[model samples]
Target: MNQDTTMHPRDLLRQMFLAAVEAAQPARGVPPYLPPAPKGRLVVVGAGKASAAMAQAVEKNWPGPLEGLVVTRYGYAVPCAHVEIVEAAHPLPDAAGLAAAERILERVSGLTADDTVLCLISGGGSALLPLPLPGVTLGDKQAVNRALLKSGATISEINCVRRHLSAIKGGRLAAACYPAKVLTLLISDVPGDNPCDIASGPTVADPTTCADALAIVRRYEIELPQSLREILESGRGESIKPEDPRLAACTTRIIATPRMALEAAAEVAAKAGVTPYILGDAIEGEARDVGKVMAGIALHVVQHGQPFATPCVLLSGGETSVTVRGNGRGGRNVEFLLSLGVVLDGAPRIHAMAGDTDGVDGLEEVAGALLAPDTLARAWAKGIKPMDALQNNDGHGFFGALNDAVITGPTLTNVNDFRAIVILDPARD
Candidate 1:
């Protein structure tokens, strides 16, 4: 094996991802924004991949007494002195999440004006706080969540459906603490960083209606339980209103976001002597489709030197969706890379990396995948068909065969996905 100089695109890409993850760490970012202790008791609650870490940070930093609970993905829990951490399912709702949501709602139901509630919101919160509405079962919400995850629904669309069905989401949690001052510090993972969309907006008002949820289910042709279908059709389960007096004392802040992560990555690229082109911080759509489009941009930069010249890196961040029609491992980042490889057709001097900032994409342990100039040729030689793999929603399998999966185990933070394309200039004459 020869060591090629070009900064080993994969290494450079990994550094960029690690940098973004570091920039959004809860221990470093969440503590400072924590509200001062109330005159009375302080209660903490939250949900996301970062919830446990955020809770731990609060526990470590607070000089006053604190007691509360938070839910996080399985295997991501951290120990805290005062707050209880509950591990639950992610990307899909489960019974454990239901229990946690119930507890969260119950915990904040009767708070005094002098007491304070510190709510931590981040990605994966929609599933982590799966409190089904009255007349709905946990099973119903779980089924809907599974379908939404496989339907290529945008984060907002999925969250809209979730908010309608949930008891604690869409400002209901904050609404529970009627007279209490609720202060929410958020780590944004969705595109656009809407407070309501982050973890289904447990602390903020959701202006989206049940009609929008119904439209999403219909667009994706998602089969919902009879009760869920009724809820959507009747438009009965409205989330808390923006002007709801119950939520008047709530204060929400987006402490971190994908845009912030992207800017940090851009700085890294600039330091490497690479002109960085930030396509957008909130690009959304199907993962593979986005990859094909990004490939076109990389080709333009390489051949035409337009938009951005070579020796440049293209950076983008956001949550992309994957419509799973097959049973292969599903990761939006891997799907994007495989699609890009096929589109580029082994174009030399161009490489790309795409991964979830949370360090897990879909159900796979690997965050995403990487593409070198010879990726397509290597797949062809191995009898792997990019189109077939993509059709089966098998980005992980495709990248796994080439040993190109970017595995960063449990990064403990979520800012959605980070994608980068490196277009190197052709060798000088």
Candidate 2:
């Protein structure tokens, strides 16, 4: 078949990435999974990059009186009539998140069996709901978060630690609504789409225990404050278990997942007259390492056409990590793209884009970066060494220098990361 060259390679690549993000949007995912209006009272509480939008979706469909509160990352708020939308820091907890967590717990307390709580959950919720347990201060929570993020601990590992030290997560939020039924709506950002892993499973039963959290913290060499360590050692940080009766009235529905987002991007590729191949939606690893593996795959496809043919797109969605050894600003997507660009070494017809679906990659406002055959050549001409950039973990700085950072400020949703490699054509003489 023939390659579709009507749209520029860079634009087509970005279009696919945006298509993935649009698929996991709260407006589209929240409506279908909304629970029916309850009998006694309907309470909504949530935390995430997408929580505000999810809350708005709930308000638009519910036909009864419902008052709620949801905290999202700063600037991610969506207005609602009854449900209060609060904004807070993300990827790290702040006093604002601490206050919001307290309010959410208080809001769900004293509910009878007739009352229903609609828990809106998504990625970023873990940090957005930072209610430290008695002996664990908010400062302790913030310190641990910083160490875990820099240590390159996986989201699941980091959340396991967070849950044990929190008074609200690990089914505690749902427990607070004792006798009241909770219908949780989640837009899963974790690999495997595990409800318990999403937002550290605030309203769901957690089979993991305090020992598990301690193990992860130790394995990652995360420096926890003495208070946090004592909580783990004393078992004071034990999470709500799976057989806990408080969770009997709770249920969850994952409205959107990385796989769904990737599928949507694949559909866009097909419509664009290109074959779309989804490698895996739940891939996990160091960002640069994953990029190198993808580069090997792409090389095989380009040179031998073994796994997939030319003129096709390889699509994937999942969260990759960065172990910060360099002084560069954070963003796993840019790191992955930079590594891919390095490995590809200016190969012909290989173009790719990687970005966080939520529009913020790491601590930076840039989503990610785009890479082309001439990326390295351009960087070298500008006296920027791609190798040095990679070593410094400065993917954002590197791409920014090349004027290639993809910025889609505040897409108001989170479904982890989206990556697409477009092998537009064969090598030319």
Candidate 3:
């Protein structure tokens, strides 16, 4: 049977996105993985957009006294009683994030073997916890972050560089706890769910070295300050290696992931009578190119029904990079949707939606936008030029003009980007 026969396509898409967000909620993901109460004290420390919420989850579940600190995006804070939540800028590290990172290191320091250090980590932690190594100014960190973000580098690559430069990340935080047992609870937003890549692996051993980080910076031709370059060149920026004894008591567990979020969205599709097909949950690449590839698959399904049958919903989740060109205000999700819209060319019976599950797509507070079959036609009718918008990287502007922008402010949890394509069955309809 055809889905959305009675339900609006946009509404179905929104419901599916919301379900995906709900699946990765810190409140739901944090409790089951909570470690036993320590004999001495339980100290909680975390960093990310969802870290405050994760701290809240810990506070609600822990039966004993606990005090800690976490830093989150400015608008994503969830108030807590014991654990202090600090708000900071994201996608770019601010002075507030620098201070919070310092305090987090101090919070875990001087712990005893009997104590347990509980760490909460998720996406955006790199920016939310920016503790530059000695001699590296916050301005330098901000400058590097700006360069890496615009360089079209993958999250893994960006984080590699971040870890090398950070004093609190790359296993340093866990090392600070020394003899204390450390249990790190992670909500994975990285492509591979590699614990080391999530939040730059503050509580786990790092496999990447300073050379590896330097190579990524060079690969993207990302300009680093001369003094910062010296840190990498001198090997002083090296992360805590896996063989380091300080991390012996560290244990990391992934509590949620992009795959889990996509599966949750798939359930929403299945319940709506639409067959759900999960495209690779770790799909990654340039946003426009990835959108082009997915569009080709969607068209094949619409025309031939070879891989998946009609009335199927294609679901995918992962992070995508954007190489800023013409300077139009847009995020990867919107850019992908815009490219998909262009490639689909208003193909009939196909509708799609793409959004960052965290409710922030790129620099905008808006999540993402929906793509209807008639989206282009609507744009043309309203005197909009799709190609011009694309050239200017103006998906947010284009979608906004069409009144199709998706907005879900501060979702409080992050699992990267979620995209869905709904193919209707004409026969069933």
Model 1, position 215, has a per-residue lDDT of: 91
Model 1 root-mean-square deviation: 2.2
List lDDT for all candidates, in order: 0.87, 0.90, 0.91
Question: Which candidate, 1 or 2, has the higher lDDT?
Answer: 2
Task: Assess the local accuracy of residue 69 in candidate 3 as a C-alpha lDDT between 0 and 100.
Answer: 93
Query: Model 2, 143-261: lDDT tens per residue?
Result: 99999998888888888888999999998999899999999999989888988899999999888989999999889888877878899999998888889998898889999899988
Candidate 1 residue spans exceeding 4 A from truth: 1-6
- lDDT tens digits, residue span 179-231, model 3: 99999999998898988898888888889988999999999999988989999
Candidate 1, residue 262: CA error in Å? 1.2
* Candidate 1 lDDT tens digits, 99-211: 99899988888789999999988899988988888889878887888888888889889889989988888899998987999999999999898998998899899899999
Question: TM-scores of the models, in the given order?
Answer: 0.96, 0.98, 0.98
lDDT assessment of candidate 3: 0.91
TM-score of 1: 0.96
Candidate 2 whole-model C-alpha lDDT, 0 to 1: 0.90
